[model samples]
Target: MTSKANRPCVQKLRCLLSVAVGILCAQSLAFRNVDSAAFDSFANLTAKGLDSIAQFGPAGSIALAACLGALFYRIYPNFKRVGKRNQLISVILSFFLALSIVVPRLMKLPNVSFNSFPNYVGGVPKWHKPIFWMVASIQLLTIGFTLAVIICWLMRKAADLVECRNTGEVSTAIPPTNLSIWERGVRFFDGKPMHMTVATLAMVLCWLPMLVIQGPAIIGVDSMVQLVQFRTGHVWDPMTMAELPGYVGQDHHPFFDTYLYGLFDELGLWLGQEVLGFRILIVLQSIVAALAIVVSLIWIKKRTNLPDSCICACWCLAAILPAFPMYMSIVLKDSTWVSIFLLWMVAFFEVIYRCNNNHAIGWRLVLCLVVLGLFSGLTKKLGIYVTTVSLLLAIIVIRKQFAAFLISMLVPAALVIGFVPMVVLPALDIAPGGPQETISVPIQQLSKVAILHQDELSKSDRQAIDRVLDIDHLKPYWQADSADYAKHYGYRLNASSSDRKNFILTWIRLFFRYPKDYIAAVPYLINPFVYGETYYYSGPVRCGWWEAGGSRILTEYPECGLSYTQGKIAIPLTNALNKTPPFSFIGSEALYTVWLPMLALGLTISIRRYRNLCYLIPTVVSWCSLFLLPAHQVRYTLSFLFVFALTIALPFAEVLTKERNISN
Candidate 1:
């Protein structure tokens, strides 16, 4: 039998989903498409102190209003106010009426603000009066409105079921409280796939405790560099006085990421007490990550009807997956990017198949694609290009999903092609500085070649090599095991374009003859991406790190502290965990999620169950993009791994479901 939902059921489900999404959107929409700094200013004031009462004073009233709104919708259907055909129309109208009231009231609700003490720290800029209130009003009102709409809808739905059971008629009355917690949960998740629900709850339970001991997991100097760059508008050289651009930092590290995290830092400033603000941010990150995991499982469960145990196993793996919580709590760009990319997969998974074969749902998913596609694309410099290429490849493979995927990418595709160059660059004064490939890939290979086959170099070749690097410097670097030969002792620091030309020619000449030499150096230079090896030339171990003078520098770096921050217990524990096996595998400089796409490729080729390569493609490309990067850090890929893991496993669960269906 086809899995498309029945008409009445589809409408009801859409209504319910819309309300749920609507409520979330209400609070979140204001934050969307707005300047990050405005929120930062709001958060800054909040950090100094917003009264606890002002923050949560409306809970009871808002809850009551929401319950009432749901009641209005529930009973309006029974009023006998309209004939059979109009019944659908009346119900729709009632939902809107309820929302109309709830939305306005919620928006008007009072929320805590920085009116009392606007400045968060000693010198950071404060929010302007108008922007501060605009942001706060949007957030506060949405909270109130969404709560009422959701509570009202939920209570009304429960009341309908209770009334249906007791009196053979649905009603608007409150639901009875005698049901067991399990039963209430069943009602709550009535139409949801059981496996999906289980997966969500499991992830929630797994990440809960980390909050109690949640310290900041500052991996290295990158986190500190970001924190410093945040205070300034642009990507600033932390070491340079007056924040002059550092030597080849953001270009190598991905400057767009600095922009994204800078916004988060602004939020941290807003939330109150730097440490506490960050913890809140971490908690928010965990929640969203869990939600993404849940959404991926739900989409999979819908497709496969996965067994409870298989779903449980998925959850178990997610729970133990070392990177999940570690990356979530850390103030890293990867964490946020991971969540966005995963959620984008939700639209991806939904579109490739069918959602009750509903066009409206498909359209909604496409709209989401445009927003998520653009946001995620713009977040990292290469993200848009990588994702665009992947989407094109996906269309070729999944011919059936071509229309949906094409429509989804149209807006973003346009912006990338036309807008980014003409508008974004000139407007933002974003200099076109990116991958210094002249140094990263070729130089590393040359260092390997020079070290392994010094005798092979002719006198002219030796002179040409010297133009790029002092061949003597290669010896000490080899002994020290420094992978970066391009920047050692200011190698290539002042080479003219002709010198660059000569070095490239020499690199290519040596590349063909001593290919094995290049092959030998590949292992460690790409160590972090290939496996979770944390041991490096910087030392087999150090607690904190950032790069400088072409080296990984270790230092204490929280950049900020808090009463409830997890820096002490969390940081040392994660670092210690990396030293061991099992967990050690998770420590790879590449994203742990990288394995999922690799696995998916293997399975998609062999097992028909694992065939949606769309989700896997971007991540695979992301992993490839790493080779182009100057450094090899796992944080670069950690944020993007979760979605694919869920997607790959879900297909297996469905394979079992398909087998069962065939047997039946």
Candidate 2:
């Protein structure tokens, strides 16, 4: 019989051989004194030797341990013990983890000068240096390996919960007969119209503190602008006697939202109390937002097999979360848009669910989608793009329901594309808001190039940029994270269509010619999404009652007789809530849901739960649009947070045999 490779003596000899090689490698690397050329002869040389030796021991130990760890890992590779589903999850998470590591670092990378086409002025430091590349690779691999192990362990626990859900092992429906008053009350409203009522009431109740403490409603500068427009028949900047341009009001602040605010202000005038009208408006707005949340929860409960506890938890979160109530109380377009967006998401999902299940397309659901779609587009300018793209995608995904989806968009599409621009806007004589808002991203890109690479810019590119923007003056207004100041401050109001066309052409050319600058420019855009908060107008909670430098609503419109007093106990209570647990995290823009959305998407895709994906389409489109924004405003993400809370329940369908597959 020949000696086997698995023999004990052979294994021992191999280990001994590995150790000997590792020590030799470490010594050779650490004790190389050739780079110590700075040392002078004799005395200096002796001192350098001591310093080198002192650094040698730790470096040698680390090198030897790394070699042994690599050998053991390659031989054992214990991660292979996980199931196929876990492996798939790990693969998905690995991509996300890599982005998490690379994107932030890439954002921080110094912009290297390009001396020639595709060649850097100074060769890339990380790539050119062997030590840097090797150390980075080793560190990334070590961290990734450790994280994968943790992921697998957590996934095992999740799989158990999923299994329990599938096997009907976990149920919250049954209530014992022996119960307290609160338990009895909960059981009583466990179903139907009462449940919806209770849910809506909970939200309204939570919002009351914001209303009572702040009084009437949280009136911001935008609210005053809307009031001035409706009251005076011309747009007026706060505190300034001068009127804005003749065409500035309609659809810029959105005439529909402004008109609603005006109606309430008129009611306040009729009642001799302007603030009373705002109070009524705030209460009704809260009701609408609360009802939308309830409707989505109701549909989710009926369609998915999510546990009662999860459903109830969602209801509580929407109702009790400090951020929701704060946003609800504010008088601005965002307050209205978020509610309409939530309702539209529910309608969108209803259509997809019916089509996928082969159920008949109901008239009620179609009408709801059409109506909600129109409101969504009308509430915000960006809504027009998001709604149109989403409906078009829905048509492509569920081709069999093409007629239903198309019909749903016809009215909203017509109003946004045809009626508003051609008839309504002109009839109202509102000047267009300009293209600056839509093209802020490109403007920011060009501004960066103008500031950093001015010397390298071609004459033609410079002329093209200068036609649309004040390229010579851009440096003073350019902000890394915001394009707002640059667009308004550096913008050329007289730039014609051709000028804009030239700028776009130049922007495209520069993007390809110097891609590193473009990449470097995007980190500011990614800060809020990847990390948590960015600069300006982003916070967990904001009471928009007043803004500095703006005329106070009470002072400017004193005839309307509004009061600015806060309840004696309001400040202390608000501060207490902000410092409290759960509420603090819930209200924190800093503690943004960085991982939740990623984890949800990964889990859903890994288990092939395609039906759940339909619920997330709007959020995906909305988030992608953020890259085009002038800056990262947290309020812009409010709709996403609302939809995500409900969609998170859908991934549990992975365990349900009946719901494993619903794709076309």
Candidate 3:
């Protein structure tokens, strides 16, 4: 019996293969007159092939709309509903109607060809046969639009499922009664007062100086055209007086600046003024970000049952932190990305804890995913890391939605792993052209320079230098340096492949062996509080009270606060009584005294009450990860520091409030 079943299965497979071969033969016969080589070349044409595709653009777009509409209608039962079906059909018809109307309009306009090609080149094979291009383009558009529709339908179905589970029984006419006072206050304020106050104050204090540095040029007081031209292309000129163009491009790694520049370009088209408009957008985003922070506080307060005042205090601490002002002033992507992330976090918490409406949660999550995907794609690649971590955490934390979690995670993961490789990598040309080689010019030159001055170096320093040059160790350092250089330059180094391999290996070994050397180079990684270049401006100024403290007292103060106060002050009588130390140890003791205790307390409280406050873990992990990355720059660390401070301060403030309430 088993043999008979296997024989039939094999026969069926063979029959299917025969049919497939027959179809292929028929297709070949149908196109027999076409030159195979010409057809092959046309099929594999490059970007120029798009022109051929455009000939049937209208029909292709309409076909695409129809196919996508049908696919979506099948996948989503909601679309099958009478009202939904009508809406979807109307949308599809309207899209086609618009395309039909627009095509004629497009034809009437100028051809606007960026390339000059003769209408017909005799004896030259066309890039793509016009009819073939039309059919292929239509198919491509149909598949693309179909996939989009399917995704949207899947999201809608998921959301509806959640809604059914969470709110199916609730009456639409009834309002929820369990609202918190904080929520009420949020509604009362209309969300502007808190944001404007925080952002304006931060900008005035921290960023005003930098803006003044550019002064009249900002407001078009100088020749606007000249200013724009100077800033755009003269990015590298020392004479331009502006800090080297922060924007990353095809040539360099100004990671955060690239996103800002992209945003500037986008807003410029809409606002009609590029530079001034971009500045206004930055200011507005900062304000919105500040407001989001406040709204998040309110959401947290409502959900956690924490006091409004405590949450507000945490928000204040975060906004007023010294680094906060400086970061907000610059049109960098980090601050904006962080602010958006915070807002998402707030929405996530609201759905998870307060709303209890899974449908709403699903929609919010989808919105977050879309925002995250676009932002990550446009900004730094680190957005991928952020999204991955968030997704994994969601899976673990919301185990009931494990299936949904897996599906949702796949969207971003596919984007990063698939689209990145297929699209972004090719566009950027990041793939190695050949076997890698070690390019050790940078390391070799540095080592040679050091060797020349060996006699001038101390014995210990000399030995350390010698260790760095050992081929086994040096290979890793060289390799890593080459890779870094490539990343920095936005292109692979042109060198022997072996040199690239050796350079990478040498850099890796050096990095692990003397991690501090590389890590210390990061601006914010070391001591986040200290602003290196602008340390003087950032430090506290001396006042009358500090002058009253006298010399010995001032000497013991940390460099940051030295101008304000030095050492412990004691009256002569008090000093004479007992020789016991009057103050805490200055350096190490002072450094750890505040931050360590708070960190320890915060960690202890958070972990012990993880179930109750697990949301805080992401905030903690984000900051700690920032610390561990190569650059420990203060600005980078400051972003997480504020997160940490807010986490701890909010709870501590609540405890104080509770105690006061009991006393009252």
Index of the highest-TM-score prediction: 2
Better of 1 and 2 by TM-score: 2
Model 3 stretches astray by more than 4 angstroms: 1-275, 315-325, 347-361, 393-398, 416-421, 424-525, 529-607, 627-630, 641-646, 649-664
**Model 3 lDDT on a 0 to 1 scale:** 0.38
Worst 10 residues of 2 by lDDT: 114-123
Query: Candidate 2 on 1-664: residue-level lDDT in tens?
Result: 3288567775676566556544443332232232233123445544654554455456545665467444543332334555777776776675565344333322332432211111112222334445434433543454344445555654554556666766778546656775544444433234378777877887799768766655556665556667666665565433222345665464546778888888887898789876678778878888999888887777666566555566767777776665666667667788888889888887787676776676667778788888888888887877877877888877776676767778887778888767887888888876455666667888888888887888899999988888888966767766665787678677777788898998988999899988877766655566445422311121111122233322333443433233343334444445555433334435543223345556666666655566667656666677688778877667777776666556665565432345555431
Candidate 1 at 27: error in angstroms?
56
Clashing pairs in 2: 247-431
Per-prediction TM-score: 0.55, 0.72, 0.42
Query: Taking the tens digit of each residue's C-alpha lDDT, what string does model 3 give over 236-304?
Result: 211112233442122122223343444564566567654454456556655665565666654544344
Query: Model 2, residue 505: what's the lDDT?
Result: 87
Better of 1 and 2 by lDDT: 2
Question: After best superposition, candidate 3 residue 254: deviation in angstroms?
Answer: 7.6
List model 1 lDDT by residue over 1-664, tens digit each: 3256576775576467545544343233212212224345557534422232133234632453344445444543343432343333334433432332222212211221111111011112224557555644555454444433433343333334333434535233646676544334323222355745565666767876664555543333555554454454345433211233432224333456656555565665677444445566677778778877777655554554333345545556667665577567666666667777777766665554442222233566678888877767665545566657666777776665566678766677778656876676556544333223435566667766776677867988877777776657556654212345445442644466688788788877877798776655543344333332332111111132223221221123322332233545555655556543335434333324434444344333333333444446666666677666545455555545576445455334332222223211
The CA lDDT at 207 in model 3 is 41
Best-to-worst order by TM-score is: 2, 1, 3
Tell me the spans in candidate 2 whose CA falls farther than 4 Å from its real position.
1-84, 91-191, 234-248, 534-552, 556-585, 588-594, 653-664
